[model samples]
Target: MKEVTPTDSEEHVRRRVSEKCSVDESPRFSRQQSFGRDIGHAAAETYLVTRLSFNLLGYLGLGYQWITRLLALACYAMLLMPGFLQVAYLYFFSPQVKRSIVYGDQPRNRLDLYLPPTSDGLKPVVIFVTGGAWIIGYKAWGSLLGLQLAERDIIVACLDYRNFPQGTISDMVGDVSHGISFVCKNISAFGGDPNRIYLMGQSAGAHISSCALIEQAIKESRGESISWSVSQIKAYFGLSGGYNLFKLVEHFHNRGLYRSIFLSIMEGKGSLEKFSPGVRLKDPRVKKAASLLHHIVLFHGSADYSIPPEASKTFADALRAVEVKTDIIIYEGKSHTDLFLQDPLRGGKDELFDHIVSMIHAEDSDALTKDAVAPERKRLVPEFLLKLAGKVSPF
Candidate 1:
């Protein structure tokens, strides 16, 4: 029997074959990954389209009017897709973003927190409730605002709650209040200052949060045992919100929100005055409760058709009538989404962003000085796209 020894060339040939086999498999593996991603993306798009379609049908019914608005909305979204995608990526993957943190026991009772880079001091907190009419409301809607504020050393808690169909107006209010209580009690663990917590909401969120704030105040005035105190909130900021459901119901109906759907979200016409912050404050019994409310600042766009600037104006006047300090700022020619979306996407020194930051940092001279010299934010969407989006926006 003879033993054979392999030569170096033979061994080299064997290794080369192994390397070739590995190389051939690599592309297949990469292709599989790519295919999986494509499938996931397709599924997400289908889900979103289906959900949006169902919501539209439920809220506006089957009509040419809604179909036309949907087309416009689709065009608007596509035009702003570049900015939306970037923010979505950051929202889902950024280390600074802590998503789906539970604040209550109910389903959808979750919130997302945007943490600043440095935890040097207890930073001011903004508990933000996002808007989505009533059916599509979700906390992720505030990702852009949360990320921007977090960059300025602010802690942002974007609260998620049960939307219409899942729950009614009262449920949404309760969820927001519960979320606020959680943040007020636990935000310190995340480097948020308890005393300087500010409450903020946009559109429907503004209405919901306002209701929660008012309800809490009324409870406190009545000596009801509460999980959170109105005194704990430093201020309330309502952005393009409707406060008087009594006034807004018909307006919303004409604007495509529809009377039936609007009434249902509001728990019917009978409950409209009960949920209306402006109307509720006019009552003498709630005057003491209103007095306990912190400063309120309302921001609305003059050209906003979703909810008119007068909604904010009338609410501010109501707050003043009860001796509560209130202020309303209106941006001329700005649409419903312009101040919140387009301006932020166009990115430099945003007037609304600056106004909010300035107020939040009012007590901190050093922060104000830093902000004064802070570099302008990089633009996400092109000017042309933003203009097109504005024209096509259904909101």
Candidate 2:
């Protein structure tokens, strides 16, 4: 120590810091490289095939029939096939699943309940809502998620609600509310803990779920229909959801068919404030239900062009602004349909699946009870202005 020189000490400190940095970063770098390689390879193959098909179709004078047939096949493959396979698996493999439980009077108001293989006592429940642009969703679409969660000892309920042309957004919301009401009262019979219910919805399902939560909060505030408090639903998992209607109004402005469909879902009214959960929660009228906002965990794909990731970001910001505890997880390079397609059981498991499982098991004591410290306030402005507007209209 008496012979130590400043130059030697500085070199020693630098060497130690370099060693620490190498230890911390090597694994992360390796993982990132592997992920990038996989995504790049897939993207390249898809691009090449698509380009080749386009060139061949152009050369062959592709007709409308071919396009129509191709579109139909794609819809079947993307929207129907996965759900069918999932339902088939559950039916053939999982013996504990109960199918077609009527939750309401309407024909579409039916749900499928999946119970774990072994249950010793009351289990936490996950009520999953499927997304199909508020136009063509089925409860069976949630079969994959329902079965997956049930395998983890969580009770799962996949609900169906009337889509556009058959029912308006308000009606669909009512149907989900009814489904939830039924689950609340009857799930105990299936060995579920009514107190630990979790609401999970994707895309349009997420929008409807948000509406239901706010509606419940309103009812609880007024002391009307207080049978099930909003807080009773331990958490909300909003995957690729549109929480703000104003952003969507701009987003779908150019897309004609979807614009009309979205308008119909809003009952042909431009009530952005009324239908938007983000805007609605900020209103002074909704202060009573502010406590429930902390229960939200928004998940979105970074490459989700169907519904821009910004939707979740802005929604989370709004909730956090009001002091509600909220969390957002971004899945890098994943698209809208890619999220569910990466099934955990099928060896296509991704970080999103792990996140979902973790949240489902998260204890109530671990939940945040107070508003997080607000970051420095910026000039008040519209949320969409902060980022270019964005998804699937359904959750």
Candidate 3:
């Protein structure tokens, strides 16, 4: 967090001026300064939500704080409940609960699949990795996305990975690699096109996905083999991924040391170089090939306060510098979770679904061969739902 000073005052002044003009470093400021810079950011978010036309009546109808508080408390209880017990709540109780989403299974892991009836064959598969930073989250959060992806005729898979608070990011990605391996081995059997599989992750999940891809890229370059069946993925979609955990550790608090602790917990030691994708990019050759833009898509809300949209910008800039094909869609005023869940701030779900569909369409043809005409699609959601209705997690 501390910036180095030049012994010569003039040189120090020059460096500051240069930084101010540089797109890369200009907006990165002290946390205190950053916290205060969001007056307009807040307003912009509010305007966006209103413009998007959320159910205003729904917001108004829930009139009391006590009502909202009670609902939130109930959700908290559900989250804190033990897993086997939670399954019971999902199964025998919770009258309002819907049926569990259907998924595919490997011997050791399971995946919840969301398939759109409207489109298939050439459609892309968006593989989701939910974030809980690294310590939390499970397959349950992925259920909404299953339904979301079903709307667009694209197939979706919410993968299960190992967790931390116990394991490290590596364990998570290892599990992810295996889950993907399972998908590659058996996806076509279930009507998914393996060649078109794309990775979409949030928070810690994003970091894990990026690392796994880097590992896969490295393995491919060295002609090394891993347990996973597939080595290459078509693209990545990162939502509020923590690319620079070091920054959060160094400047914001003393928590940077936790990374070493995390490393110790996972791998029995710490190596920033081993854990960080940003650090891994120091080698120009590796960076050139591993850049996700060539095979990925990024969605980030500019107003995200938790992880800092700068992380996305940093990753995008790094990818773009290498001339990798990347598209960054920044919702002018939105936050982290808001990118995925309903955000009163910005109207983007339909657009998000639309973009996902179009991306699938674009990647479908070029996926295995050269790109082709969009397949004639009709009633994609209904048929896909029918096929998935009686299914369960396969793993």
Alpha-carbon TM-score of each model against the true structure? 0.87, 0.71, 0.61
Specify the highest-TM-score model's number: 1
Model 1 Cα displacement at 361 (Å)? Answer: 0.7
Stretches off by above 4 angstroms in model 2 are 1-89, 253-256, 343-348, 364-395
| lDDT of the candidates, in the order given | 0.86, 0.68, 0.53
Clashing pairs in 1: none
By lDDT rank, best first, the candidates go 1, 2, 3
- Name the TM-score of candidate 1: 0.87
**lDDT (10s digit) by residue, model 1, range 1-395:** 01111122333423432331234456779557545644674476468547765765665668666578778988999999999999988876576887666677886787888999887989999999999888778788899999999999899999989877778999999999998988877777677899999999999999999999999999999999998999999999999999999888788777777788889888988999988999999999999999899899999999999999999999999999999999889999998999989999999989999989999999999899989898899999999999999988999
Give me the overall lDDT of model 1. Answer: 0.86
Clashes of each: 0, 11, 14
Candidate 1 segments exceeding 4 Å error: 1-60
Residue 375's lDDT within candidate 1 is 88
Each prediction's RMSD to truth: 12.7, 20.3, 22.0
